[model samples]
Target: MSSTDSSQLQQQQQQLAEWKLQRLIKSLEEVRGGGTSVITLIVSCKDQLTRTSAKIAEELSVASNIKSRQRLKLYKKTPPNGLIILCGEVGDDTTSRGKERKLLVDFEPFKPVQRSFYVCNSAFHLDPLRELLTSHERYGFVVTEGNGCLIAEVQGNVKKTLFRLTASLPNKHRRGGQSALRFDRLRAESRLALVKKVAEAAGEVFLQKDATVSVKGLVVAGCGDLKNELKARLDPKLQNVIIKMVDTAYGGEAGLDQACDLAADALAGVRLVEERRAIGSLLEAATREDGAIRHAVFGTQEVTAALRLGACGRVIVWEGTELEAVTRRHAETGEEKVDIVAPRVAPVVQTERDGGGNGGGGGWEELQRVPLIEWLDREVAAKGGELTLVSDRTPEGLQLVRGLGGLGALLRFGVQAEVLESFEESKEDGGDGGQERETRGGEEGDDGDDFF
Candidate 1:
């Protein structure tokens, strides 16, 4: 046992440890995106040996310095033979007060940045400790698209791999500790890869249409072996759409099936109509016949023009399209409007009477100016079209709007042409009422959640 030989062995061990940490970080980068507001790291050891724990913490601090400026919180737990460490972010503040300042100066600045804070707790309990960490304001859930199942909760300004879905690796899988280390390392890496795939898939579908469709929410439906895997792979922006989870393995096709069914069922009993392409064509024709030729899709350069001319009953758009503005070129006279009804709405009003009703709720329901897809539902109702939504009762015989794509048809069948004029009148009256309520509420400082 020569001194040089012992020194050489120590150097090799240190290099190996550094290599493992780098690999762990690489795994986190592969899987996390969008919904991740923070990065949380959870580490467990047999004994919270002061030197070992401090060494690990130092490595984390250095690694985080090169990442985003997310707040990093670190916690260490020590047992007779092992130790555990947890790190994440809190609030908008994540800067280290004194000596640590120079360490993180070079990392990319986080938007809405502020000072980062790190706190350590010696508590041995895992559940409360985990709850304490994830409950921070920036706590956003993370999921991926492929691999069926997996979910992660991230925290921190710098996108560090804080806590993983598999927080702990079992001892039985370890062969002289080496196998256990490899298994843990492999699991984290694979999960990260899945997260990347899901983010790409979500982004691909989101940009398919002409409009920008922001993900308002996300839901993981059905449960199976891949539950956590799927949850971890999903994009963070879609977290809002997550309504519920049903237990099943409907697989790829079933994913949309379950989601649509749930959304439709939830929206049941809400009197709405379905207007598909047929209504678009009808509206197009009507605008041309009324001598509001400018109101026709071709006569107008902007959608607002058609809207101002009262040409649009409503616009139907697919999910993910941005609500900013429409940019498609106008169709020629016989170009066949985007749909069957788009060119006919204005024409239909020509033969029908105008300036009919001025009052509200006079044996007529209120017409709404809603999103394009919602307008589809209204159009379907107008045309006496069947309303099919996802439901348990098959004999109900309704047209299904399936999924959260938000597609709908408008209801415009029985109303006399004269009734259309009342829609404008009703809108004006509603606006006045809304104004009055807002004024009174402002005086009273109404902080209620519901808005109009």
Candidate 2:
């Protein structure tokens, strides 16, 4: 192939590699190994690539000795950068002995870890993975009527019903007569009592287990008006946790299952809800215009500056944003540097040759594109700040992206009220600009106004 063709091929390969890495990151973020027998193993291939497979096999052998029917599976076909993750299902026996075992798998060739180690754990140990992925999610579910049940997504689809209550409610209809009027009044009182009982049950679950503290949001569903009445009667803590309310045909476990299915979109988009809340908090604080609590900043430059100063408490960025960064390298010393820049800008180039006659030398490469969300995620985490990836899946997220330049931050310390006021002013001035930018560069069909 010609030099041009070779260069194009290399660039394509790099793009493909980056894409694969991103895909793996997303997969790992979403994966939650079910069952108590799930095992996760991370091994370093730095010096033992040749023996890595055998080392893994040995580890599995030892694990099998302790856990029955243990089957080890690699996330990737080949280890990337001398790193491999082995996730095993310890008690899986669905595969026939005569047939080859097929395991649900995903791979990440490169992970942020310093050393190689093996761990045999039940319940798919995730702390090791969370260190790199930084996914903290909490979800809850509630199904109620005359009866009520509350479940939480402890992990993945595995839900543990935290509370269950059954109340005998009075009949809905009564015959017309003076006696019937008394019966109707009695039934009204009975229904009211049932509502109180259901609310008390929910409050007990929320308070005893501290569900409000851990559950990010909840879905409530049920037949009849009982669900609404329960909501009205619930304590403020329980009431605030409700994310969605749906009408269901059943109650109890079946109702919970139906609620889960109906609210799958909300549950799956919990991150979006979180981002909305975070952004809303920032907006609220900004509106106060209180200098002591004016600890919020928006726009890319301001957020980056705040993060660098360690003032960022949380970083929020729109889901689909690309940023330009510059990478510089020295010729003789082999020193390197990188700096973030605005998107779509041409890369800066600086070349230098050593004293030798040869043309080979280090140079600065400009316009290297990076996923802004990924970069900000790492930056915020490294700075001990929470990172929220907001998308158009939520109205608040859309507003953030469309009105606030697709980036914002909650600071650790307060800034001058004028500074935040300026941000709001800039937002007002550039709100249309941001929307136009999204229209031209964002995902097609995104109106920045529709509710998800």
Candidate 3:
């Protein structure tokens, strides 16, 4: 496919992997099992999966083939980020006999697994995976007020100073000499030069080898207006990304430390602001009175229908949504089917919690549960659409989660949700293009790789 198509597919795949990893981590935290019953495995991308699988063939033989066959086989070669699997039998509690359940989850970690490990323990090993999930994005900090400047970058939690420069400003004469006025002029020029130096150093620390800003955000901090002066001296591109201008009692390393603590709120608010923007855009389109030209649709059933009909594109889902992609068998006919929905009640989980939910003698028997995000990713990727996960911390986000049923989408064109739902287009032959899609810049990519 084209470069644009490749990038879009990669993004969707990343989102899917992220969703699965988070869901697994949350569910695994609650699991309790015998010392030698629950198995946890971590393999780095450098390791060969074929060899690893052969080593654990006996250990994995017990897992359900229907559930694991594709997962195990998909990586004829290992993925770029490696793999993490927590599987095996576990009880409702720490003891072996209360209630037994099969728990299995396998997916790529957020970052590459640095080392390989395997164990059967009372609880699933999570510390290593948690470390990998820590974001690698860097944040740049410039702490200075015309003297003892500190330019540093923070990756994950570690901070490394890029430079520490004492200002070269002229010292004023003690006596009220005729040259005392000249020293003040020299000091002003030196300060301006210092700001320019700090700005250049910050650009170096924040940008990558290709000149792209690698830092997620920049925080300029120091006492007085020096921080503001430094921001103004920064490159236009860097100036635009400056998250905060904080004040500190000191400059250099001490101020750098203080800036980290002081700018914490701004750093946190960056993500919350993005979440609001994502949901706010969707809400705007959804509430517009122009029915014939409105590109917004909400509610899972309506959004799913729009997606399948090849209309809606940008999908925004609440990060904390409890919806699941499920399959149910007809109580009488026993015919199986797929559904994207929320659980009727609080879900009791483990292996069967998602993949094999069933009604306790209810008329509609639940069949399987998968994360709703995964299903949305597939449809969104197929249409070259964007998938955003909006957090619930902001008011706009709450409107999306509470008012929009936790999911909403903006269509490629203005198509009524009702009309799109009932518009049944016949499936074309396999040799012919199956589902016709609105051309998005280029013709819709027909390459159907399982970007799970």
Candidate 4:
């Protein structure tokens, strides 16, 4: 070939490389920051899978123009499915002979705001992959000869190592090549907390000086009497949380059984079932849901909803329901979560007729469903919003149901009954107001005005 022709070809190739790098940058810039977007990249290399995959990941990270300067982790694997499962454009694929290795790339994007997590896998040339993972045309990489896999993460706009695990050849399979495959599979199955998408304030409580954070698992309990109680008691005012409330029939302590059933429905998503340490962590970080909390003064629904939605600036739930599990969803984000109480339930009791009994002997009930103590918990979490539940000074109690137990709170203000039951007509002192109101499906005077 003539010298002039060769020089022209080199110039054209350089232009193409620049164009591809620009395209990748544009694509990455679409993701917002502050834990809103998450990206995961997995690469399977056959010949030099580990080295090649690492190189590509570094390039992609640099190329991605995320708003928050997010972190990116590249996982490497060499499994039996490496050939079929991996996809990406590399230098070797288009050549006459597979002499040179090609790089395959894939992209996965997550939007916490949308409550959606998606995966996209594709291939790219080695030159471009390296350019995108790291900004510069070339960056140094650590390539271990025997290590099969590695994982890295970026958070708060800075790349940091959350955790990295490598497979060491086990003696039992030392003689064969397949030993690495078993190790890779086992590592993938183990759970890790890479995504800390929960709110900042919520995250703080989990990291308290003395308190430890634990995520047990998530169990869904459909709507029933227990669900109602949960709604009435534990519901918060947060938005975009990750909890789901369905309908069912059972009630009482057995209500938890129905929760197990609901949780089973999500068997396909085993990760959701994994329990965290306490309900506080979930509530502090969960996204918002579609429904908004209706403010009612006489009952717990309004207040509980406010707390669950992360709206209550300061809250206090009665001591009776302490240490109970609460399921709260965000009003805007539809993120649902289960909250485990740290201290316990502690609520003040007041004497009042059952309203259902004729002789006023059924016993008094709490003026509010959740006690002031519980409200305090939700209030602390709703700041800027964050919720921080402090250790309670009052003693704890076991009585879950209030009102029926004669416990109540001295709310910020005297709760207006209309606020609790928005549907009920306001009480008036006129002559025609003497007749008592009756609940649906209940006979007139059967439960009496003093029973509820």
CA RMSD per model (angstroms) = 26.2, 16.6, 12.7, 28.9
- Please write out the lDDT profile of model 4 over residues 1-452, one tens digit for every residue: 69865663453333233333344444333322222123233333234454533444565643343211122223243333222122222222233434323222344311011111122322222332333323221111111112221111111111222223243322224443776777655543431111111122233322235443311222223332322332332213211222445454543223333333354443322211111111222333222232342222212434443333334432323222323333333233233333332222322111123122233333222122322334343344334222212112211111213321212222232333444344232211111111112112212222111110
Per-residue lDDT for 1-452 in model 2, tens only? 79865664453333334444444444344333333334455554454443544665665554464342222232333355445344444322343334322233334443444456555544444555545433346676667665445544433313566777666666656576668888888878887886777677656655645454466776768787767877888888767778888999988767766676577667753443344466778787557666455578787657765665678887776656655333434444444444455544443433432121134544443323445655665567688777655555455667887889888888888876566455444433332111111111322221111110
lDDT of 3 by residue, 1-452 (tens): 89876775565455555566666677668677765667777778899887777756665544343134345676777779888777666644444585566666777776678788876677888888767646667788888875558888765434677887887555556655897777788777888888888888877777778878878888888868777887888888788788888889987766876776678777653343345556767877777887465578877656766776677778888767765565555454344445554434322222222222243332436555556777677668788788877666556777777776888888878885457545322211111122221111222222111212
Question: TM-scores of all models?
Answer: 0.21, 0.38, 0.55, 0.16
Per-residue lDDT for 1-452 in model 1, tens only? 69865664453333233333333333223221122323332323332334443544665653364342232222233332222233222221332333121111112211111222233322112342323222132222223233342322212211122222222213225464656777777776765565555545544543336544333333354444344555555555454455445554443433433433444444222111112223344345444444322222221122222333334443333322212111111121111111112211221111102211242212211122222323333443354333222221111112221232222223222223344344334333432221100000112222122111
lDDT-superior candidate, 1 or 4: 1
Q: After superposition, how far is residue 7 of candidate 1 from its true place, in Å?
A: 81
lDDT of 2 at 109: 41
The per-model lDDT (C-alpha) reads 0.31, 0.55, 0.66, 0.29
TM-score, candidate 1, is: 0.21
lDDT of 3: 0.66
Cα deviation of 389, candidate 1, in Å: 11
